[model samples]
Target: MTMSKTRSEGSLPVVSLPLPVDVTAPAVARQAVRATLGGLGLDGPEVDDVLLATSELVTNAFEHGEKPDRLEVEYSDGRLTLRVFDSGTSRPKLKEPSPMAARSRGLQLVHALSDDWGHELCSGGKYVWAVFSLARADASA
Candidate 1:
């Protein structure tokens, strides 16, 4: 896996990690997100929420999408955003899982944890994203 950090036009930090299209992707994503966000001086329950949301997006990409590509994290204007790209045309939906179900709650958890979340179709495939408001997150801490 390859990871790099860059700056957007707004001079905010953006980190991207190419993820392996396997079971290990979620763990790898969590580790990278923790280190990257921590290095940016972000911590506490909000950061943990971001981590959980990131894991859900990556997990969804690996399970439902095709050829998961990379995970990107960006911080800008008091908000942090994460995007998971995969070569799949299908879009994810927010569904309420059954009480007895063993899975399918990833998106629900993401919706609860993130300030906003959605997916978009790109030229190659699609990317699912979640955004967190740092100001609100800090207030909750």
Candidate 2:
């Protein structure tokens, strides 16, 4: 994984990374996410929600989509945005998994936790994204 500071959005900083396509992608992503959010002075539930959502996006790419390529993470104006791009053509959607099923609730958790979540089809594949609100008042809690 590689990280670099990007142009600022308003007063908040933006950071983007190009990650490898491997089994360790999720772990790598979680670490980067923690550092970025921590550096921005965001903590507590905001950090937890973003970490969980990041894992879901990366894990979903490894299990259901094609090779994962990049992750763009940004904190701007009181919100966090995470985007995971992959080389698969599959469209992301929520599924109704049986109660006894051992898996298949990644997107569901993202949908429930994030203020908003969605996926966009790109030229080569698709990019899944989620946004979390972390206003100053909420971050301190």
Clashes (backbone N, CA, C under 3 Å), per candidate, total 0, 0
For residue 41, model 2's alpha carbon misses the true position, in angstroms, by: 0.2
Q: Candidate 1 — which residues are off by over 4 angstroms?
A: 135-141
Best by lDDT: 1
- What does candidate 2's lDDT look like per residue over 26-116, in tens digits? 9999999998887777777768888999999999988888889888887787878999989898888799878999999999999989999
Candidate 2 regions exceeding 4 Å error are 137-141
**Could you estimate the TM-score for every candidate?**
0.91, 0.91
Query: Residue-wise lDDT of candidate 1 within 1-141, one digit each (tens)?
Result: 567876673765689999997999999999999987877667778888998998999999999998889999998777899999999999898998999999999999999999999999998899999999775345446
Residue 9 accuracy (lDDT) in model 2: 87
Clashing pairs in 1: none
Report, for every candidate in turn, its global Cα lDDT versus the true structure.
0.89, 0.87
